[model samples]
Target: MPLPDLVRRWQPGWGRCRTLPAATEVPGGLRVVLGLPGRHAEIFALDDQAVPALAERVAEAAEPTWLTVPTTRPGEVHIALENADLEPFPDAERLMTIELDDHPAHPVPNAYWAKTSEFRGVHRIDLTGHDGTVAASGLAAIVGTDAVMHDIRTDPAHRRRGLASAVMSALAVTATQLGATTALLVATTEGEHLYTRLGWEPVATMLTATAPMSALVRT
Candidate 1:
């Protein structure tokens, strides 16, 4: 299926833009908007649309704090910042979703977490080895019926011993118990097959962009 059509299959609360047509705006805004479900914002050509008029509007908005255009033409005054925290887009990543009850119970392995913590809506589990050093970790947040996992990482030396799986399993167990029925995660190229093996199905191709770093300084 076409990328846009596949994107449409995302449930309204999940991937609303999965099936977005090439030219449709996401509801309201000056042809741009934020929080249209999933991560990132949706906007038109950054250079042509936001140079003077829309740039002023971006400065005025209280949240999201940047302008995002999925594509750019030549000579656009946008910066694709190369930094650790830069958003992912254009190249493509996997947006995977899975049903909670579709798999076996995801109980945390007894030796998995040397420490665990939760504050407000976020949950964290630290996977430690015998020496009590943190080997891997995972995080998840539950909002309504959705539990999305982020930043699940493991140290190189600890990679294939199922530590990553253990962290996710623990997170899944906790998230499900907290009334979450839907799970969402974005996987990198290296991790995509691993997630698929764990039963997550890729449903869309995502492109993420954000306001240039200069925008923040100018504010």
Candidate 2:
């Protein structure tokens, strides 16, 4: 229902995935991480009140950790840090959750639909044009009962032709076959508008963090 819970559903096959205080109670308190060997940490339902304590715990953990929460509450930074500038993402605060009923009906040439490859349960699809160039591409990763659609992109020359929608439709069909009932993704400003038209909703905002060099190098 809520966006954070929706995100937690998509994370699968991890060493640690549970609520901070307890599983029975939830509002803003879930920690989905592999710890130690994990590249980063994702914690949801973590209200600002919990961030300080959470940061302390992280400081004492097996190693330095970069905690990313849906809210701007900062466990990795001193104060709340939202990438309004969209440093790496280029479109800030536009996280969306999507679900399609069966498949969307926007006809594309059958030749357009091609499954390029699949690895580690993630499926990749490409829409190639008559010239055999990759016009659009998307990926779906089925983890547990949740499916995450990611990295949907269309070539600049292929924009406005609905190739992204075609890719999404194909991925949605594949998701159902994999038994995933829900799908989620983080969208950019441009993507948010396109996805909304294709039936996705802006459910929540996302904030991500990574360990700084100092932290990473700390003994």
TM-score of each: 0.58, 0.65
Model 1, stretches more than 4 Å misplaced? Answer: 1-91, 104-114, 210-219
Badly placed stretches (over 4 Å) of model 2 are 2-4, 13-48, 54-66, 72-79, 82-91, 109-113, 209-219
Model 1 clash pairs are 7-18, 7-19, 8-18, 8-19, 89-208
Candidate 2, TM-score vs. the true structure? 0.65
Evaluated against the true structure, the overall lDDT of model 1 is 0.55
What's the count of clashing pairs in each model shown? 5, 3
lDDT of each: 0.55, 0.58
Report the lDDT tens digits of candidate 1 across residue range 1-219: 332332333223232223222333432222333444232244433233333444444444455444433222312333332232333333445667788776444444566554678865578888887777888987777756777777788999788777777787778888889998877776776778778878887764333444344222210
lDDT of 1 at 211: 38
